[model samples]
Target: RHYGIVYDNLVAAMRAELPKTVRFVAGRVSAVEAGPERQRVSIIGQPDVTARLLVLATGMGDILRRDVGIERRFVHQRQSLTFGFNVRPAGASAFKHPALTYYGERVSDGIDYLNFFPAGGVTRANLFVFREHTDPWVKALRDRPRETLIETLPGLLKTFGDFEVIDRVSSWLTDITVAENCKRDGVVLIGDAYQTSCPAAGTGVSRLLTDVERLCMVHVPQWMASPGMAAAKIAAFYDDPMKQAMDERGLELANFRRSLTIDTDLRWRARRQVHFSRRRILHEIDKFSPSFAARLRGLKRPQVEAVT
Candidate 1:
């Protein structure tokens, strides 16, 4: 059983609704000053633009954060590596399922998971590995992806049917980080500009979406109505309850996923065994009797989990 979502089209659909006031600046920011009343933004090849408030949605690699005394504290220097490629059915037959997920079976494999799904008239394959970028296994996966993946995940071929690699593997090395001492005057940090998420955890977009909703839909309008854009006003957005909860959940999930995949301790090892055992038992029950499975769903366990 597997599930997946396509984000590229969703992004394109959202961009279609952008207001006319949203102008795209095509230049490097030479200087940024978070003034008490307004922000003085200077671009290398464009005229300076002053605004009552400035939001930094720049990525983790952005260096403009230094001017505002915001520094990234690396939580896990290199948390996970992600590989992306396109996969198509190898034979005349099509795959039974539109989307499929394959979780790593062994701790020693260092392979977290793999997802295959339909997107843009083709099937996309994404693999998440809890291994170093320079490791021999990582290099092997990059050079000979099909052969290496087949060897690593023997059940993959049987589960999803034969598939041919249709594109080059795109890889990403994620460094989990959180911004520190970012509370300043007029400028506010959001999305990857404030924190970097582990690709394996799948919390990156959730945190960023929360940031955008809390900042734009709620905080920004309220802040603009006030007299000055000072540190006091900026701190209010950081103290937002929804934003705080999402940030905490992202970090918690990062640790939980890493431990679930690689932790070989006694408790985690036992937990993993029980986790898969439960899923298997429920799946069996569903196959034999759907009504009986529905009865089990209401007993002590979550309806979704028991049914799943």
Candidate 2:
């Protein structure tokens, strides 16, 4: 929840609007049991709660999926690793811009990209690596984050300028996955509880949001009007065209980002060269004439900078 997302604040603000009938029981869920008539949820150190329908919005690591006959099949294990830290301009050098992005130079380097931006009163750096967690590089990062990163990415310091990692380097290893055998009675899994997204693809939140909108807004209301909480009704949500498309798109984008990052095929190699070359050209043009750069952007040619 503390992954620099605004969800905590949003929920905190919504606390005041909670109706008297809606009692918020805050505790960890230990077990879940679901049936056609009623669903029972067991919380640690608390009495069980029964509901007509059970919604599992827990992200990524919920064990309740198995209880509802949902399966998580990993499409790719150890897909990517991400590092989050704060950076500031070294000494009095002073950053000229509020944000900047630096792309990885080599596939062998195992670096995907690095994003440096201002958030929560600090310049936050999100770095994506396409290497195994057990790799020596990963170990080096854990032990000496700044030096290891600079070593792996030679041009990083020169491009982003010498900056210190002013906080603990938070890291995450992601597994690309999708839930199977999930269409069940009375229980529905949403967000990362249903499908896992590659952080490097930046589609995790998008997929989760699509899940929320479809399950909550589109399907649930219609189901409530009907008779039984059968698997058939639950399957309709998964069969929804929009939800299917978004899930497919998330998988597609995940593959695209991975290929773009480390695929050394001739075609991809050329595209990568052209991709950065075009940005360099535009950057030079921007330096020469800000107005001209803004005007040129009206052409709608995409200027993509990987934000990790």
Candidate 3:
């Protein structure tokens, strides 16, 4: 299934029902002042409303994080052109099975993982080429996105055969990548606000939603029931859970990033050792239960319950 299509359908469904139950507040949150019983959230437009609980889903904004003294580790520069192509099978040859191919060297090289998926009768492939954050090429063509796309597309075509470009996407400069220990007192950070991970791991959106759901379903309800739930209590409820989730994801992302992006020769050797060790661990797990590998494969299915 195309995620873009599914996302559009989901958005359409939400848009249809949004006006009925949810009130739309279209202004910026200027300030958040915590009090004894409720939080006084000051908005640019509305001034008279106060709530017992405040949920800020205001994604990865540096200004908001700075206000609460949360600093990030990895700088959130944009990932240069990761190209997607929709290819029609050439002549007598047909794609037998979909596969993800990882190519090139550890740190300085490009094309980390290229995924080929069945699209209708054709093949839709996405090529992820790693461009360094400090590269001069990225700096020169940063402002002109189309020029960057033009530069990256030819290389992708040469490596992966000729295919038509479907869509292109890039990350924002202001999008934050924070360290494991970045959390605040009064305000609760969820999603990308807490920590940003590399897209290579493919866990960012899932992790974010899981954090939100855990807080809303378990923690927030419990906090509401407490007799003396102050701002400190609310902060505590969010702190541990958010921190644990972010740390686990952050470590995984860092490992994955280091494996693909580190430029040092020594770091390459270290990553090779880590990769071999990880494979050995997997092999040992497979030996324990023959179906362990199969079950692990099944975990990638859409219906599988993700770890919170």
Writing each residue's lDDT as its tens digit, candidate 1 over 1-308 gives: 33344676777677778888887666788878887797988899789988998888777766788887788888888898899999888884788668887899789988878988777778888898888788998888878988999999998889888888888899999898888887889999998889888777777787899999998798888988878898888898888999988887777777777787899999989867886787688769989998898677557853222221
Q: What tens digits encode model 2's per-residue C-alpha lDDT throughout 145-196?
A: 8898788788777666778878888999889888998888898887778888
RMSD of 3: 7.0
| TM-score of predicted structure 2 | 0.87
- For candidate 1, list the clashing residue pairs, or say none: none
The residue pairs found clashing in candidate 2 are none
Q: Which consecutive 10 residues in model 3 have the weakest lDDT in total? A: 299-308
Q: Which candidate is the best by lDDT?
A: 1
Model 3 C-alpha lDDT versus the unseen true structure: 0.54
What lDDT tens digits, residue by residue, belong to model 3 across residues 65-146? 5554556676545543354556543433644434434344334445455566664444665545566556665554445533
Stronger candidate by TM-score (1 vs 2): 1
Ranking by TM-score: 1, 2, 3
